[model samples]
Target: MTSTAKTPLPPAACATALDPTAEPFYLQVLQALDAAGVPYVVGGAFALAGLTGVERPTKDLDLFVRRADFDRLDAVLGDAGLRSELTFPHWLGKVYKGAFFIDFIFASANGLNPVDDGWFERAGRATILGHPVRTMSAEDMLWSKAFIMERERYDGADVAHVLRGCGAALDWHHLMDRAGPHWRVLLSHLVLFGYVYPDERDRIPAWVMHELLRKLHDEMLAPPPASGRIQGTLLSREQYLADLRHGAGDARLKPAGTMSAEEIAAWTAAIGEPHEK
Candidate 1:
């Protein structure tokens, strides 16, 4: 296991610059993960706040670990009294401390991107809950947050906030690669980010925009890839289920481009409730 060591936090009497009076339980959780030698990158609201200085009330801590490390994590944390469950097998796992919990995420709900060691390489250092931790990269955060278009939990705004904060500091090339087949999704967010923060538009590299725009232009000029393929689900898993199920089953709909029926079912099941379109 690759150790994710950072400068140890000072004693509890000292107030860290990030979050003073951090919850002791959260600190315990971080300590356990670290002591167990779990390689994880802190993510979610804590990470966003740490990196972008955007403080939001987060319900729980999010620990982003590689899928390959999950079993090891389970092995180590279980002895520390943190009960874990593969709650959402495709993308999420959970470590519970009674009412409070930590989210252990390895993949996107869409099953497109998975966490790897590269995530740690680009990670920033932070003192979360008064414990030294690695923060997820802005590029990976953008890629992960790009897919969250649910009715109740739209993360487009968060994506824009990251761009506003990281902007020129972001690794555009790596981000572009992370966007992959979903480059259009990234382009949409970047366009909207420009709209949301007009003055910061130049923060994004001109070449990045040019590449995305060129791709968009080519896509527009090109004929449809196939007939009857419902691309709607790619945007939102819940929004296009009707189109995928009841709408004319278009043979040309490339299952590879978007979530297949099985993936959709698993995602829906994983959430433990029906999603609002």
Candidate 2:
């Protein structure tokens, strides 16, 4: 069960823009979630804005709802005359209201991390769409954003800004645990963050740096994971299909996640690339 502290928004005010004068589509969805008692933590641009005060134009609202509550959200949105779909059963769903959409996220696209009860405990409250809503924690957001290094969309800068803006407020130890086996990704971002803002280098904890460096040193001396599969394809499905196809006969080749061959082929085709011959 999630928590809500803010009072309900008036139907008329639900449509109000972020300016609170004009109703926005995203708010309407938020209002519906409130009515249905669905526990959600707002993320993406809105959460980023609330957490870091760096606002950017967003195409849609991102709401992280627990997997169990998704059906509840689906029914609530339907009753509110909205259309929705579970685009990826493993990780995401979408609620459509006219031209606007809400990305209902349950887990990371890479299938590595999930939004569990711990996320709710760490969420911070903020006023979004004229209603108070839980915002994702900096640590959770950083973990979620770390793997979004697709060809067209890279969120490294966003990660750096969160590091810069949140500073000591971010939970370094939790983030390190969240990164887990993927600690190298975290180290790369930290290195870039130091490069992006030289003055803020000290903002990141010294032990975190030492720990990551230690992991790197240990990795350099150790053999790679037993699986001969080239996992780099996990970084970007579209960009790495060639690597996967070329190694099709190699026993070491394996998909990094749950993405099915059909799904991968469809995804590649959507980007206008021909299916592997």
Residue clash pairs of candidate 2: 15-23, 15-24, 16-22, 16-23, 17-22
Error of 1 at 200 (Å): 2.2
Clashing pairs in 1: 229-253
Per-residue lDDT of candidate 1, residues 1-277 (tens digit): 3323222112122122333333665787788888878889888877776556666666667888887888888877788877888765657888777666778888877666788889989988877644788888888888889878876679998788788777757788888987876788899998998798776677677889999999999999989866656655545666666776686453212455434556456666545363211
Please provide TM-scores, in order, for all candidate models, with all chains considered together.
0.83, 0.83
lDDT of 2 by residue, 1-277 (tens): 3322232111111121243322366778888888878999988877777666667666666788888888888899888888988876656788876556678888876455778998899998877645898888888888888877787778898788788777577778788888877898899999999899786677777888999999999999998777656556545656666766776322212355555655455444656332111
Worst 10 residues of 2 by lDDT: 8-17
- Give the CA lDDT, 0 to 100, for residue 246 in model 1: 80
